[model samples]
Target: MGLEVERVNEIAARVAASSGLEVVEVDMRGSGNKRMLRIFIDKPGGVTHEDCANVSRELGTILDVEDVIPGGSYVLEVSSPGLDRKLSRPADFQRFVGSRVKLTTRNPVNGNRYFEGRLESFQDGRLTLELGAPKKKVKAGDSAPQKVEMDLSNVEKANLVPEI
Candidate 1:
């Protein structure tokens, strides 16, 4: 279950990169008898159904050639990340600037640890976010980034919150 998914993800990544797209995320699940592998991808132009189809065809051939999946019957699903992307990498934070994000910390901060706010910046292992409070502006290269200091280890989970 685990290694097969990783292998599929690796194949999806290679095929996407070769096709000028970015592999977003991959999910592998089972329905008691069948397995489903969902591969998400994105790019500067966003991703279309055609893109997913193309990746599915190509990566499918690659996976079959590699025999990553055994005799277990499975279905392959290729998709896009949509608006709510799981923030896993520092690069994910940078990609989501100017958007609302929900984050939980490893330990509490300011009586409550969970935060949902406007993502400001991510640079040099630092993430600065403006919580939904009184609008206090902070200039570039100032104390604002310091106040929002959160060690990467403190990030338990992060997701782009839908602004609606």
Candidate 2:
């Protein structure tokens, strides 16, 4: 099953690249005939409805030809990752430095699993975040905002917190 998902990711990446886009994520869910394959794509300026339509058509045909999933009908959907896009890769974090983000770690750090802060930097596979709200109150003139440093490997999920 994992291999099938990897194959789908590879196929989606290759197809998206040919179409001048990058595959942000490929998700395969459900089982049997109910399975659905969702592919998220993006580029410098962002993707259009046409981009989604083209990728969907091309990837669907390729998957069908490759016989990747065997005897099952799966719904194929391709689209832009959107404003609150997920940060799945280390480079994603690096690209969005200074943006607000909300992330969850696989294991609790400082007895907490969730964090929302401004991304400060990403270097050597580590991320530094300027925590937006301090866990404890400090006098106005006492201290600067707190910071948290975490390794990429510890991240279970992360998304850009769109600042409106």
Candidate 3:
């Protein structure tokens, strides 16, 4: 039987928590015999190959016993969120402060929908970014460019700019 999306997420979250991990995302693609389920997991330090293997083994058994999926022959993949992990929640933005981020706004901010800079601060559902300095400054000693302040509601997508 095909489980509802919410039910799948709930079950995945429960399983992940019991295994000392958090489910960052769950994506199901294709259908019928070609179904694929990809689960992103994370922890304080990081996840190893063993961690992925363990979660896959345990979750697979649980799903099989529960009959959560509708069809046959589906692939389940469990792994770390990775270096360029997507920022999907408010906590994600807060946790990644001081890191480089590439973001797109739902509407233009400063006549632009795209922005790439160092995340300076995130508070009260707002984001501040240091976009570096402009090439020309009026005086010998002019301040570096002012930070860009944006509301969280305006963000369409954001991702950590991987260092390497």
RMSD of each: 5.6, 2.6, 3.8
| Local error of candidate 2 at residue 160 (angstroms) | 0.9
Q: What lDDT does each candidate get?
A: 0.80, 0.89, 0.84
Backbone Cα, N, C clashes tallied per candidate: 0, 0, 0
Instruction: State how far residue 51 of model 3 sits from its true place (Å).
Output: 1.5
> In candidate 1, where is summed lDDT lowest over 10 consecutive residues?
138-147
Which candidate, 1 or 3, has the higher lDDT? Answer: 3
| Residue 89 lDDT in candidate 2 | 92
Clashing pairs in model 3, backbone N/Cα/C closer than 3 A: none
Better of 2 and 3 by TM-score: 2
Point to the candidate with the largest lDDT.
Answer: 2
Q: What lDDT is reached at residue 44 by model 1? A: 78
Q: How accurate is candidate 3 locally (lDDT)?
A: 0.84
lDDT of 3 at 105: 94
